[model samples]
Target: MRLKPVPVEIEKGKINVDIDLEEGKTPFIVVYCQGEAKITFLPEHGETKVVTHQGKVKRVKFDEGEDF
Candidate 1:
């Protein structure tokens, strides 16, 4: 359970979040879009997706928050 501060960029109508993790480490991302922005994900079993490799980039269809 570590905390990281990552920068997000919004382009067109999409947002991108990136992660940099060490070996044998995993992360859980929870994002909530604010204002006139809306976001969604596929295969939405949104919770506890783990990353288990060093310098590995894993993608998941995790959607846990809502926008207004």
Candidate 2:
């Protein structure tokens, strides 16, 4: 199955991404950024993952709003 890419909005140096996924499946997201970038995932369980990748692109796996 091919899922549509979620829309990401960047405003004032902050990036906002809202994604919806199906249950019992794992989905990955590839984000392209210039230079170094930091990504933070805030889940419903109050667990947060802060990731910093120094490159032009980053690929992260998502499972039930879990960490990367």
Top model number, lDDT:
2
CA lDDT scores, all candidates in order: 0.38, 0.41
Give TM-scores for every candidate, taking all chains together and pairing residue i with residue i: 0.29, 0.26
Count the clashes in each prediction: 0, 0
Model 2 misplaced stretches (Cα beyond 4 Å): 1-11, 23-30, 35-55, 58-68
What would the per-residue lDDT of candidate 1 be over residues 1-68, giving only the tens digit for each residue?
A: 13333344445554555543454334345433332222222233335344434544343233355445
Tens-place lDDT per residue, model 2, 1-68, is: 22334344445555455544554233334344652333333334433232447743434433445446
Q: Which ten residues in a row have the lowest lDDT in candidate 2?
A: 41-50
Model 2's number of clashes is 0
